[model samples]
Target chain A: MIISIVGAGALGKTYGGLLAQQHEVHYLMRSEYAQVKREGGFTLVFPPPQNSMQIEAPLLHQDAKTLPPSDLVIISTKTTANHELGALLGHCIKENTLVLVIQNGIGNEEWISQLVPHNPLICGVSSMKATRLENNTVEIAYIAELRLAPFQAATEKQCEIIEQAFAATSPAIPVKAYQSYKEIRWRKLIWNVPFSALSIIYQQDTQVLATRQPYVSIVRALMNEVADIAKADGVTISQEHMAKMLEATQKSGPYYPSMYFDSIQGKPIEKEYIIDNVLALARQYHIETPMLNLIQTNLN
Target chain B: MIISIVGAGALGKTYGGLLAQQHEVHYLMRSEYAQVKREGGFTLVFPPPQNSMQIEAPLLHQDAKTLPPSDLVIISTKTTANHELGALLGHCIKENTLVLVIQNGIGNEEWISQLVPHNPLICGVSSMKATRLENNTVEIAYIAELRLAPFQAATEKQCEIIEQAFAATSPAIPVKAYQSYKEIRWRKLIWNVPFSALSIIYQQDTQVLATRQPYVSIVRALMNEVADIAKADGVTISQEHMAKMLEATQKSGPYYPSMYFDSIQGKPIEKEYIIDNVLALARQYHIETPMLNLIQTNLN
Candidate 1:
């Protein structure tokens, strides 16, 4: 099966390179298409001892008039750049093209659903953290399970075809399907809402937040607020989930999150999808989220 | 008249040097006593072309046997060092000593009042911003009016003696006495609570806060919260006073508050007196001070 990844960033390159081991994968990057084609393919370096392999996937440029419709088209870009998605994917998406959006934060799927109204939309929340080492190399920080849920009325066969494309990287890149996209998004928010905002505000990473007393307490309060907002939105988040999120953060060690890295590099932050959405829901539910609002104030 | 200025940091040195122009003044500092005494005298530099003069006030060490009773004893130190005031001032404060505590933040007077119960206690909040240039010298950033109020039952004659001691330097260092110490402290808090907290949080100074929009809005909210807490404590802060405070902040230009500077230099912050007192009063009156509490969380 043919798979096309829209973004060419760390996440896009990591997953695209892994799937390229078995299937025909194509990377869609407008600026770097020529250089990538000239270099033959990019390199994917896993953990030590694992030989770095060349990813020979073909390159797709932005200027192409028409795109070959693939079995699955994965949208893996920063939410800030989502504005260009419609123009980029216009010719690439077919009627039955399984649109799998593996992006961070909330509300991106609803955006795509509006654009490709008839396509079977599969929304996946990935916990697999990755980083681009160079222009032609991508590194995987940790291998965690990816949670996939259908946006609207996606059929089982479409989910199967999407999961099959990732089967080669299974176990290490396992996928778990959920019935409701909203629940999965909220669950992912349990980690994103607190860690992302705090790591930026305090200038500390996951380990610092986990070990420090008041920071740890603040993390609990933010998570609880997110849970309350989610429950008000008809989604119930369990206490066990909260504990698991905190535990995972403690185990991640001292690691600066993507938001912290972006701030240090003076890049545009993805606060709208992460914090703005939670704050909007909080206002709608008449919920008091002082900690979250404080974070929002710092970001603003 | 003799005046012994305790805690010879910036605030201590500035007021001490000014008073030395008229009265026989002495500065009390534990670590810098030998150096200050060896230097013979330190210079006090006012803003611009004003000729900086040498201050020949004697320096007092921590191990000084018995302190010569001063007509006015001005305690100008960070609130954190108030704990050591008992040991330091034991031999210094006389029964009739005018204990004018020109300290920042709250709760210090309460502690000092408990320590030196018999001495007439005067609480003065100085808006004069100054910085220490060397071990003995200090630079007055702005020569503003200093508000002096009796803590308990300090007589008007006592206030007069304190003001008369500062009369020689009155043009550069004006003093205004108030009837209620509580009211003046709360008024000073209208400026301190927000600016100090925000400067530390956003790592920006007063000018940044005044010019910025949302930050300006947050400052108003915090000031309003403080005013509400003050009112609940039986002190009526006028709307005009609030307007004046905001206007003064806007005109003061860019300046880092003591708290921000302290945090940057890795010194102990006076948050307990500034924020904790406000939060305690807020909780006592069943008032909601979410923004202030949010600032408290970050400090913790």
Candidate 2:
């Protein structure tokens, strides 16, 4: 199976490197193209007990137009760059190719659906913690499940095929499929919207956000706001589920979310996908999200 | 009249310097004492058209216990230092002294009232923009009206005398006395709560908060919340007043509020008086202030 990973940042490189172990994986690169090509491939670093390996350079396409069409295209770009998706995906995917958006926040699937209307879109959120140490050097702190859901024309068979592809990797990247894409996305937001946003705002990590006093309360309020917005959008996220998410984050050991790193590096964040999208839905549903609204202001 | 400026910060120095031109003014000093004593005065820089002046060392006392009691004691300390007011004022004021609490935010008068129970407490908010340049130098950008209101047993006669003392200064510090302290505090909060708190958070000035989108809306939302809390607390802060406050702030030309500077200097902010007190009132009234609550979390 041929798989193409677009916008190969930290997550993109990690997932693409893993898939390259099992199948032919092509990385569409931009800034890191020269170094990655010079390095001959990505050096995948796994935590202790799990052996690390290097992926010898496969087909590294700097331009999307030069890349061959593949069975699956993973859109792991920071959703801030979703603007370039139409041109990138248009030049890379075939007529029934499955496009998996393993990105944070809401509106990615809708944006991709609009960008590449005919493709089968699979939207998923990865719990795996990965960081790009340098160009073509990907460090994996953990490999967790990639929860996937079919959006629009995505079928069960395609989902299963994608699941199997991940499962066959050197260290299996667990995959779970849900019936409702909205549920999974909002569930992810239950963590992402508050911790990701607040981590950047407070210049602190998940441990502080989850365990601190007023911050803990603010996180809860933000989660409640996200849940209310999700409910209004036809997705019900239970209080127990939100509590579990907070509990997991409290024990996540001062982890900085992708958005925090983006802010630290002075790069544009996925504020549009993660926060603005939720705000738009909240506005559409006439739900007042004052905390979310305040967070939105700070993002700018 | 003998005027004792309790906290000789930027505003304290400016006001004290102005009053020293006419009335006998004494400055109770702390951190700036040694430098001020060495210089033998405070250099007050007035905006052009008004010449800057040097206030030769009046009775600059480091120990409040050693200071002589005054007819009027102007409390211009950051509300964060309200803890020290009891000891400081206990040593510096006479039983019937007119204690003018020229500070920011709510609860200041209440706090001072408890501290020096028998004094005629005049609670006020100054619109003057003053910044401490050096140990004994204060640069005055603009000196606007000092809006005062009697807290508990402060008499109209005492308010008039205080107003006249300010009026008799070389360049008059205009003072307006309102009937209700709560009304004046809340009215001031329509500007202080949002601009002061957010300026610190964004590390930007009032101009950005006032002119920027989403932020402008946020400022409005915060103002509305403050007004709601004010209304619940029996103070009527009209929309027109809030709009005027925002408009004034927009034209204030990138001014950094005192809180912003305090944050930059790593000093504690007036979060308790400015935000937490309002939140407490909000909780008491059962009014939802999501923005204020979130701001409170960030202050910690």
Candidate 3:
């Protein structure tokens, strides 16, 4: 199966390189395409020492109109860049193309779905952590399950084809399919709302959020608020998941979330989906969210 | 009438100098006793250039076993020092001395009352703003009414003596007596909790709080929470007062509340009284104050 990964960030590079092991995988790069082409490809330091290897994944430029359409095109960009990427996806998509958006926040799938009109939309939330160590290399620091949910009803053969492409990789990243895509996104928000938003506000990393009493209490309140918002949206987020998120943050050590790094680097944040989306939903549900509202106000 | 002003910080110096205009006032100094004595006294720059005057408030050392007794002793110090000051008040209180604590926060009156069990207790909440500048001088930038309320019932003559002492000053700092001392303190907390707590949290001043959107929203939410807590405590903090507080902060310009300055300077904060007292009351009233509670946790 032919696969292409859009938005050449760390997440895109990591997954694309892994899939390139068994089948043809293309990376659509805007800025680094020339450098990667000249160098024949980039390298990926997969998790564990021995798994590291050089990857000669093919690179695709945005200007190439005659490029071959792939069976699957993964949109793995920051949520802030989703609008532009969506427009770009329209130019390359085929009738049966399965477009998967592995991004943070809510309402992203709907936006991408509208941009690419007829293509089947599959949304993904990955726990696998990766970093682009240099201009031509990415390091997969941790590999966890990658969950996928189709926004529209997907036939069994289409689902199997998607799963087979992932399973064929030399060391395939785990994938789990969900029935309700909205529930998956809302559940993901339980962690993202507090960790992403607060990491930026406090200008600290996950370790500090876990260890500090004040931050811990605040993070707890924020998580509970998000859960409340989710429950109002007809998705019941369990207390067990909230506690798991807190514990995971503590165990993750001193890693900065993407939002924190984005803020420190002076990039535009994805507040629209992460914070504003919840606020919009809360307003619709007539629920008061003073805690989330205060945080959102500060982040703004 | 002879009077002594304990805690020789700017707040104490400002009021002590004003009283020294028409009566003898002594200032009890902990660290600057020798310096103040060598300089004869510190100057008081009262509001409006024409009202500014030199003040020769007599200095007293806390170690002096035979300290002068006075008709009234105004305890004006940071709440952080209240514990030690409460112990020290026993050393200087006369049998009939009227003790007026011109301080911030709620529990100082109770603490002092415990130390001097029988003396008439009058609590004064001053809105006059002053700063001790370099070179041993204090500048009274803004003059507002000083509200005085008795903790225990005192004779009319006792109240008159306290009020007259303030009125006799050259450019008298206005003083108003209140019937309910607890109400006055809670009303003051409505302003102090948000400005003081947030100023410390954001590490910014009043101007930032006034101008910034999310911060302004947050400040408003915090103010409302305090008002809610106040209502639970049976003190009706009006919406008018809330608006007035917001307007005051905006008009106050770029001033750092004491708590913010303290946090920046690495000094111990007065969170125990400023934040904890409210939380305790909230707990008692079965009121949830996630906003104030979060700020308090962060400050801790």
Q: Find the candidate with the highest lDDT and give its number.
A: 2
For model 2, how does the per-residue alpha-carbon lDDT over B119-164 read when each residue is reduced to its tens digit?
Answer: 8898888888888885567888887899888877888888899889
lDDT of 3 by residue, A1-300 (tens): 577788878888878877777757777787777878888888878766547778764656655353458778888878888767745675457888878889888888878877777788888898778877666888778777887787754544565566777777767767878777778888888888888887887677878877775577678777777888788878898899889878978987898877887788899888988899888988889776656866876776
TM-score against truth, every candidate: 0.57, 0.59, 0.58
Better of 2 and 3 by lDDT: 2
Candidate 3 chain B lowest-lDDT run of ten: B57-66
- Could you give candidate 1's per-residue lDDT for residues B1-300 as a string of tens digits? 778877877788778777776777777776677777788767677877676767774655556344667777888878878877888787678778889998777776888988888889998998887887765677777687888888765877787777776666834567788888888899888889998988888787887786675567668778878889999987898888887877877887788998998899999999988999888888989986655766787676
Score candidate 2 by lDDT.
Answer: 0.85
**How would you encode candidate 3's per-residue C-alpha lDDT over B6-101 as one tens digit per residue?**
787888887777777677777778777777888888887876655666766375565634447877888877888877875567567888788888
For every model in order, the fraction of real contacts preserved is 0.12, 0.06, 0.00
Q: Cα deviation of A284 in candidate 1 (Å)? A: 27
Judged by TM-score relative to the true structure, which candidate is superior, 1 or 2? 2
Off by over 4 Å in 2: B1-300
In CAPRI terms, model 1 is classed as incorrect
Those runs of model 1 whose alpha carbons end farther than 4 Å from true positions after fitting are A1-121, A124-293, A296-300, B64-66, B170-172
For candidate 2, what's the RMSD? Answer: 13.4
Residue B248 of model 1 has an lDDT of 74
Check candidate 2 and list the clashing pairs.
none
Clashes of each: 0, 0, 0
DockQ for every model, please.
Answer: 0.08, 0.07, 0.04
TM-score of model number 2, chain B: 0.96
Deviation (Å) of B56 in candidate 3: 2.9
